[model samples]
Structures are given as C-alpha cells and as structure tokens.
Target: MNPREHIPVLLEESLALLDIGRDGIYIDGTLGLAGHAEEILKRNPRARLVGIDLDDRSIRKAQARLQPFEDRVDLYHADFKCIPELDIDFPAVRGILLDLGMSSYQLDTADRGFGHSQEGPLDMRMDDRNKLTAAKILDKYPEPKLAQLFREYGELKQAAKLARKIASVRRTQKIESTTHLRGLVEEVCHWIPQRGKIHPAAKVFQALRIEVNQELQGLGEFLIEAIGLVGPGTRLAVISFHSLEDRIVKHTLARLSRPEYGDSVIDILTKHPVVPSEDEVARNPRSRSAKLRAAVKRPHGS
Candidate 1:
C-alpha cells in the first residue's frame, strides 16, 4: 500500500484554524503522512515546517511525500512530547498542529498489531524502538494491574472478569498474537448485548494502545511545552479522535487560553471544537470521530 496517500482527517478545518502566514514557521507534531504538512507548505512559499512522529515508517514516508519542498520541511523521528529538544532552526514557530489519531496505515498494516481483525504480532508500540509490547503486558502484568488498566483505560465494566480470563488463558498458552487476544476478549464479551456499532474489543485495544504509547500522559506535557514555545500571534491546533484524548486537549487549551489562570499568553480561537463536516464524514468514515480545537497566542495586553 502507498503510505503517502493516507488521507488526513479534517484537513480543511485544521488548516483554516492554523491561519498560516507566508513567512511563518510551523510544527506538525504528529506528522502522519505529511498530508497536512504538504498543504501548509503549499499555502505559503516561505513558510517552513518541522514535522515529527514516533512511527519510523511515517517519518520516512512523510519525508518522501514532502521532499518536493525539501528546502522548507524537516522530518524528525520523535514523539511530540519531546518537541522541546528537536533541532528546530526557526526562531519562533507561528503554528503548531497535533493530529492525535492512529493513521490508516498503522491500523491497516495489521503487522503493527493495532487492528482487532488482523492476525499479527501483539506489538502495539507506536515506536517499534520501544521495548514493551502488548504480548509482554498480557504475560507479565499481574491480574490487579491488568484489571486496573482495563477498567480505567478501557472503561470496561467487566474489567476484572476480562483480566482473569486473560491471565487464565495465557497460563495455558502463550498470548503472542492479535488473534489470540481478540478471541480472549470475545470469549468474555460475547454475552454483552449489542447496543451500538462499536465492537466489543474496541475499548480494550484502545486502552492497550494508549498505555503502550503513554499517549495521554505525554500529550498533557507536550501541550504545555508546545504552548510555551510559540511566539505571540502563533496558533496551536489539536485534532483528537477519542474522548480520552479530546478531554486532555480540551482542558489544556482551556487553561492556556484563560486570562486568569494563564500568563495571558494565549487566546482560545475555537470557542467550541470544529468537527469534520458531514460531507467529509460521508467521504471518509474515519473522519467522523474527529474534533479540532485551536488557540492562538495573544498579543501582549490584548
């Protein structure tokens, strides 16, 4: 599959909120396929981009897709949370973007072990460089800890029961593949009455991915650091697909944009989050869940 062709969700809404300036500098903290980065560059010839991602495949593909604008873009193989140390040459970045969803490539690759349907390794680390994998967590974590992970992160009502089943299954046979885990989850959840379109194992997989990547924890820190790095009039935009991530972005932006709590450094741009349009959702179902929040650095005394 051509990884470069992965469609970025809410593309128009994100770029619109960014309000790109011709000579400005920008950072795409979650540069998936450089879809948004490419558009940002096309909007302004003199604008420069610092694109970063934990996924090595994403970095390589983004580099190639953005190579036409070689002079204006720099790709990095790092997490957004570590943006403070990236080799940014620009004096003041005018815009920062965080698209916080796993890309189509990641979910579809199946070997990466993100999808519940695809039978592959139980590795869920966004950065393959990381040591921990889902299989390790399944095998090593105690029942209490696994239950806590499922309850808190997955919000599963039967967290304890599910954890017990996982522990029981792993003892008899190694839980080293996606299919193995999926079957285990299904066994425990087959009794749950269908009420909506969501799969029974969706939340479990989501929780594991978040835990594996330390996504929420890293996001909170990254937002604070990223907000402090931009200059006055700079814009920050975040697109979150899930409620957990959306909650973090929503609260962080609120605190930063507040005149009382904050240092009066930024102003909230999107009073309410901008969601994907109905047409966009129809075209791409994945875009349906996206919510975009934006804030701009306030001019001194404004």
Candidate 2:
C-alpha cells in the first residue's frame, strides 16, 4: 500500500460544522498528511492554517503536501493538547479540528509497530522520542499491571488471562517483537478467525499503543482549556476513532454546553455524533469506526 495516500474521515461533515468563512485563522490540531488542512485551504483562499502534530515524520509530510500554501500556513511539531498553552491568536481563530486516530501511514509502515498482523519490533511510540515502548511495557510491567492496562485501555474480556500468559512467556524470553506479542495474545484468547469478529491481538496492540503514547491522558482538560481560550463563534470539530475517546468528547461537549452564572461555554453543534457515509467507508475501510462531534463557543457575557 502507498503510505502517502490518506482519506480524511467525515470530510464534508467536519467542514460543515467548522462553517468556514472568509479571511479567518483555522487550526488543524492533528494535521495528519494535511488531508483536511489542504481541503480547508483549497476551499477558502483567504483563510490561514495553523497545523500541529506530535509525529515529526507526519509534520514533514504535511509540510511538503501543503507547500502550495506555505506562505499562509504555520506548522508545529507538537501535541494538540499543548495548543492551549502555545502562543496562538485565540480570538481570531475561526475553526479548529482534532482528528484523534492513528494515521494509515503509521500503521502501514512496518517499522512503526502499530499494526498487529505485521512483524516489527515492539516500539509503538507515536512520538519516537518517548522513552516508553511496547517492549518496555511488556518487559517491565507486572502481570497485574498488564491486566489493568488491557482491561482499562483495550477493554478486553480476557485481559487477566492474557497478562498471565505474557508474564509466563517473559520469564525465559523477552517479548521483543510485534508478532511475538500478537502470537501470545492469540494463543491466550483461543485463536479464531471468523467473519465480523475482531482479533484479540488488535486489542492487545491498541492497549500497548495507548500506554506507549499516553493517548487518553489530559484529553478532557485540553478540550475545556481550548473552549475557554477561543472566541465566541469559533467552532471545534473532533473526530475520534474509538468509543473511549468518543465518550470523552461527548461528555466534555455536554458539560461545556451547560450554563454557569447565566453563561455557557459552547453551543453543541452536533446533537448526535456524525458517522462516515457508506461510500466513504467503502473507499477507506480504516475510516469505518470514525465519529465526528462539534460545538461552537458562546459569548462570555451572553
């Protein structure tokens, strides 16, 4: 597969919620391959983009892809959670988008260790600078800690049994490879390949990936901070791939929509989460699980 190919999930739905207008600043918090960013720029000639991503490789790719609008674009190689702290023009910003999902480029690449079916070293750090690796977690974490990680992050049913199996295996040989860990999960979960059933190894990989990157940490706080920073009418669109993230986004938006001292933070734009169309799913199978939610900030004194 060509890793360069990327299809942004719920593209039209996200753009509609953003309600892109003329001559305003926009932010792409998770600018993976500049797919959504490019679309924004392409549609609005007067708009400027501020793109951020934790992956340096992805940033470089986005840079080259967005070369046409380099003069009007600002790209940052950092996590989206830090945007609230970063020196940004908060009030003038028109829209912001956060697509929280592993890009196809990362999964398709063999060395990234994000895919379970492929054989690679167990290094699942989204930002490679992070000291934590999937191998380190497998090698260092005790059986109970491993169980907790799988149970909480992956929501796996056989977490304890799988953890016990990993603990037993690591006693003699170090769990160093993706295939090594995947095989253990399959064995412990009782190997089965049936239609419409997800593989146990996928859950194991997801748990490890979340741990390695600390993906869910501080997400709700970031949303609150961002909503408070942006001006009234600024729209925030978020596309979350898994239920855990979707739940957090949903609850946070709901909380922000309530009034405090006769002033609410945002008006919920998406009453229900928007999902991908059937044609989009057929075009990009990886986007099938995506759900998009959005809200617009309300006036402070209103």
Candidate 3:
C-alpha cells in the first residue's frame, strides 16, 4: 500500500481543536505520510508546518506527499522527543499534533514486521536506525523481564505463562519470525472463539514493539516539550491508538490543566477523548481504536 492511501485517524476532531490560524505555525510530531499535515495546510494556506518523524521511510513519503507545500512545510527526520532542541525560526508555534499509532504503511509492509498475520522477520523497529529489534528482545530477555514487558506494556493477563513458554522454546531454537512468535503465544494462550475477539498474539506483539522502539519511554517528556514550544491559547492534540498511550496523554493534560501543577499551563478541551464517528470508522477500520485528546495552553498570567 502506498503512503498516500493512508487515512489519518481522528482528522476532523484534531483539526477542529487546533483552530488553525492563517499565519500560524504548527508542528506535526508524528508526520506519518503527512496526511494530517496536508489537511492542515489545505485549510490554512498561509500557515507553516514543521513535520517530524523517526522513520526515514515516513519522512521520505511525507516529503513526497507534501512536495507541493514544500515552501510552507519543513520536514525533519528526527524523533518528536527532540522537539525542544529543534532550532527553527518560528516566532511561536500555534499548535502541535502527535498521532501515536503505527502508520498503516508500517503495518502493511511485510518486511517491516509490525503485523503478525504477515510472514516476516520479527523486526519491529520504528526507526531502522534503532539497533534493538523484537527478535533480539525475545532472544535476549530472561523470563522474568519478558513477563514484566508483557504485563506493563501489553497489559496481558497471561504474561508470566507466555514468558515461560518463550523462555523454554528459545533455549533450543531462536524466535526469529513473526509466525514463530505468534505460534508460541497461541500455544500458551489459546484463542477465544468469540466474534471480534482480538488475536491471542496481538498484545504480545504490541509489548515487543513498544520495548524495541522505546515508544512510551520519552512520551511525557515530549508532551511537556511540545507544550513549552507553543504560547498561551495555542492548542495541542494527540491521537493515541491504545489504552496505555491514551492514559499518558490523558494524565499529562490533566496535570497541566490543574492549578496545583504550577501555572495551569493547559486547559483541557476534551474531558473525555473524542472518538471517531461510525461513518469514519466504517471507512477506516484502523481508526476504530483511536482516542483524541486536546488542550489549549492557558494565558501566562491566567
């Protein structure tokens, strides 16, 4: 599948919250294919955008997709966590957006190894530059540490059992492919027969991917830094695909919204996350799990 065919999750809700100004400067922290960035620029032709992504493939695709707006868009091949360190000349950022879900391109590409249904090597690094891969994690991590990773990142109930299964199996043979790992998970945690039930190995795959990419490690730090880059009344919107990511965005915005948390830097705009409508979800099944949370920075004195 081409990057241009990828549909962004919660596009309308995020853009509504951003309230794009004609001459405003915005940052798309996870510029996967520039889907949302293109919409933003389309809505406000005079606005400028800074798009950042860790995946070189995404940067290349986004650059191509946004080529028409090259004069107004600056694409960077960097992690969103480095936003604060960026030396851009924008007077003040008017908005920031981070869609923390794996792009469809990443999941659909068999060699990228983000999906279990595909027969590929168990390499789920978001950035090809990252040395750690899911295969390496499974091969090297001990039973106890693997259990912890599954429990914390995946929230899997049978984490210990799955870890023990991997530990026993890996002693004689390495778990090098997505198929091998999926089989191990199915062996330990039998699949439920209920309709719409998620795959038995889904959570395990998520845990390994998170561990390999350190996706959750610097998330809070990045949110804080992104907030700092914007001025009072500027908005920030984050669309997270899973509960773990949504929880982080929810709590970070909450803390910033509270008066006790110093300047009350942010005022929560959505008390509950904005979910996609039935029509949108029908058109894009991948958007079903998305949760969008937005907040506006309070004026400095207020």
Candidate 4:
C-alpha cells in the first residue's frame, strides 16, 4: 500500500453534515493525507481551511496533496486540542471536523508501530517529539499499573492475565518489538476461534498506543473548545473509531444540546451516530467500526 494513500471514511456524509458554503473558513482537526481536505476544497472552491495534525509526516503529506489550495489553506504542526490558540478568530470559522482514528499511512508504515499484524519497533508515539513509547511503558510500568491500563483503555477481558504474562516475560528479556509483545499476549490470552476472528493481541496494542499518546486524556475539553470556536448555525462533526472515543463524542454533544444546560448551545443533528453502509465497509474494511456524530451550534440566545 502506498504510504500516502488514505480513503477518508464517510466522506459524503461528513460533507453533507458540514454544509460547506461558498466562501467560509473550515477546520480539519486531524488532516491525515489531506483526503477529506482535498475534497472539501474541490467542492467549495473558495472555502479556506485550517489543517492540523500531530504527526509531522502526515503534515508533509497533506502539504503536498493540498498544494493546489496552498493560498487558501493554513497547515499547522500542532495538536487539535490547541485550536483555540491558532491566530484565527473563532467567530469567522464556519465548520470543524475531528476524525479520531489513526490513518492507514500511520498503521501500514512499519516504522510508526501502530499495527499488531506487522513487525515494528514498540514505539507508538503519534507525535515523534513525545518522550514516551510503548516499549518504555512496558519496561517501566508495574504489573498492577499495566493491568489497569489494559482494562481501562483497551477494555480487555483478560487484562490481568496479559499483564502478569508481560511482567514475567520482561524479566527474562527486554520487550523491544511489536512481535515480542504480541507473542506474549497470544500466549496468555489463548485465542478462541469460536469467540471471534479478531487477534488476541489487538486490544493490548490499542491500549499501549492510547497510553503512549494520551489520546483520551483531554478529548472532552478539546470538544468544548472546538464548540466555542464555531459561530451560530455552524456545524461540528466528529468520527470516532472505538467505543472509548465514541462515548466521549456522544456524551459531550448530548450535554451541549440539552435545554436544561446553560443556554442550549447546540442542537444534536444525529440522534444516533451515523455509521458507514455495507458498500462502504466492503470497499474499505478499516471503516467498518467508524461512527460519526454531528451537531450545529444554536443561533445565539435563541
């Protein structure tokens, strides 16, 4: 697979929810490979964009793919949580999109270490600038702490057994690569063919990635800040891959839409999250788990 290739999940549905206008500013908070950004620019020729991504490699790829709209787009090498600090005035922004899934490029690239099916270094930092790595977490965390991480982040049923196995293995040799850790998980979890076809180590890898990047730590706060940045009637859409992220998006949007909450800032556009259709799933299997929820800001004081 080409490292630059990424099929933007739920592209048409997201565009419809965003309601892109003729000449307004839009923000793609997780601009991976410019897949969605390119389409947005194509649909609304005069629309300007603010693209943000933590991965420098992604930023570079986005820059190249979106070069045709260079004059209208501002690419930033920063976390989406820091959107409020971007010099742009929030009142003028028309739309905001947050896709909380890792891109195909990040996962397929062996060096980035996000996949369980391939061999790579146990380094899962989304931002290479970060000090922590999955290997470091395995080496430093105590058995109890490791168990908690797996249970809380991955929602794994055998977290304790997996943690104990890792602790015992690391004593004999350093857990330096993806294969080593995956082997440990398979040994402890004992994959059951009847349960599901999913790999036993999948959850463990996901848990480590979440911890290494602190992905869920400030998500709700970021959503609040993003909501504040849009003006009246402007929409915010988020695509979350896992239940942990989907829950956050669901509850935050629900809270802001309630009349009992101060001022009723938003109106939930989708009562239930929108999921990809069977055709979309067939075309891109990775998008099978994605769920998108959108809300539009209520007219001020209405």
Name the top lDDT candidate.
2
**Residue-level lDDT tens digits of model 2 in 156-226:** 99999999998998889999988988888888888889998989888889989998998899998899988
- Which is the winner by lDDT between candidate 2 and candidate 3? 2
Per-model tally of clashing residue pairs: 0, 0, 0, 0
Q: Which ten residues in a row have the lowest lDDT in candidate 3?
A: 1-10
Per-residue lDDT tens digits for candidate 4, residues 1-302, read 25336889999999899998646889999998888888899999889999999999999989998898899999999999999888876777888998886898999888888898899999998899999999999999999999999998888899999888889888889998998888888778886555536786878889999999889988988887678767887889999999999998899998888877665389999999999999999999899999999999998787
In the predicted model 3, the residue pairs found to clash are: none
Better of 3 and 4 by lDDT: 4
Query: Model 2: runs farther than 4 Å from truth?
Result: 1-4, 261-264
Runs in model 4 lying further than 4 Å from the true structure: 1-4, 192-196
How does candidate 3 score on lDDT? Answer: 0.87
List the candidate numbers ranked by TM-score, top first.
2, 4, 3, 1
Residue 130 in model 3: lDDT? 92
Q: How far off is residue 276 in model 1, in Å?
A: 1.2
lDDT, candidate 4, equals: 0.88
Model 4 poorest 10 in a row by lDDT: 191-200
The TM-scores, one per candidate, come to: 0.94, 0.97, 0.96, 0.96
lDDT of prediction 1: 0.84
Strongest candidate by TM-score:
2
lDDT of 3 by residue, 200-284 (tens): 6888889998998898888986787667666787889999999988888888888888777765489999988999999999989
